[model samples]
Target: MSYLKCSGMCQLIGGLLLLLLAGCSAGESKFLAGNLNAVNHTSAAINHFSVNGYGGGNVSPFGDGGGMCCVMLPRQWLPGLKLKVEWETDPNPNVRLPALGTDAYRAAYAKHKANYQQHSTIVDLPSYETESLCSLKVHFLSCNQIKLTTACMAYGQPGYPIKEPQVMKEPAVCPK
Candidate 1:
């Protein structure tokens, strides 16, 4: 009877340890699976705006060899991933509805430019994991409609790099 009790206790402890190990491995795998799809989607969206008399540009990622999985032990448990996107339109040939002259267009352009600058600065600061920054600069060149220039950046992740601004046919709209 003593021998049987000891065996059962050992077996229970071993099973618990195995269960714990499995849980840890699962968590690590989840962390390894970063948001690559999100990056691809962003790239596609930027590419879509490449045409239509718009210029697009992007920046490369920080490190090489794709995105790092477990940069730090704590990261393995709680990954510190980030994605930042910024966009702006040119002031020439305003696209806003009801084209406004040089002065009005310039004012609107300045406003948007300031807004973009502010957003860019804000994103640079440390914040939450999942955050986005989008800015739109629309100029009214005609009675109704405006021209747009968009710029974006995707950073923090290993594989994903900041993308160049794409010439979107439509006005710049930030992704949700």
Candidate 2:
């Protein structure tokens, strides 16, 4: 009957629309994201770093909140070797690292301070500049050994991207 055909067509169009909407929402989570590569020229070891930045101006006054940025460096290490880290973005233009350490904890702490000075503001979180975030150089023991480090900074909570979770309101229409 005409009624059955019309209903079937309407359901097909609705499904297609839902798929398109989901695709667009996928890109809405992060404003900027990518990897930074750090190399130890002396030992010929390489470390890959991943960085992420989130949050931008929202349309509603009560919409999501401030933004944050972070960097991750490789974990490879050596006893005598030091890292030559050129922080990607420095809040303070004057701060520079001429030397590196043996362990990762010390290196991370030291780099955090230098980066804070270059990119962060003393006043407010939302107003801080996101571009000054820097990449780090991870040291390694030997040519064959490699360690990958991952660090993430989020502008909002873990569930930010999926603002509204879908609810199953109706069951699928199945043949009896």
lDDT, residue 30, candidate 1: 26
Candidate 1 lDDT trough over 10 residues, lowest sum: 41-50
Q: After best superposition, candidate 2 residue 98: deviation in angstroms?
A: 39
TM-score of each: 0.20, 0.21
Which TM-score value belongs to model 1?
A: 0.20
Tens-place lDDT digits, model 2, residues 33-84: 3233322222111212122221221111112221223332223322343222
Maximum-lDDT candidate: 2
Candidate 1 C-alpha lDDT tens digits along 55-174: 224211111112212121112223343323333323222235324667777787666545321111111212224322232222212112223221233333344233322322333653
- CA displacement after TM-score superposition, residue 39 of candidate 2 (Å): 2.9
Q: Which stretches of candidate 1 lie over 4 Å from their true place?
A: 1-6, 28-121, 124-176
Count of backbone clashes, every candidate in sequence: 30, 10
Q: Worst lDDT window (10 residues) for model 2?
A: 117-126
lDDT of each: 0.30, 0.31
What CA root-mean-square deviation does each model show from the true structure? 16.9, 24.0
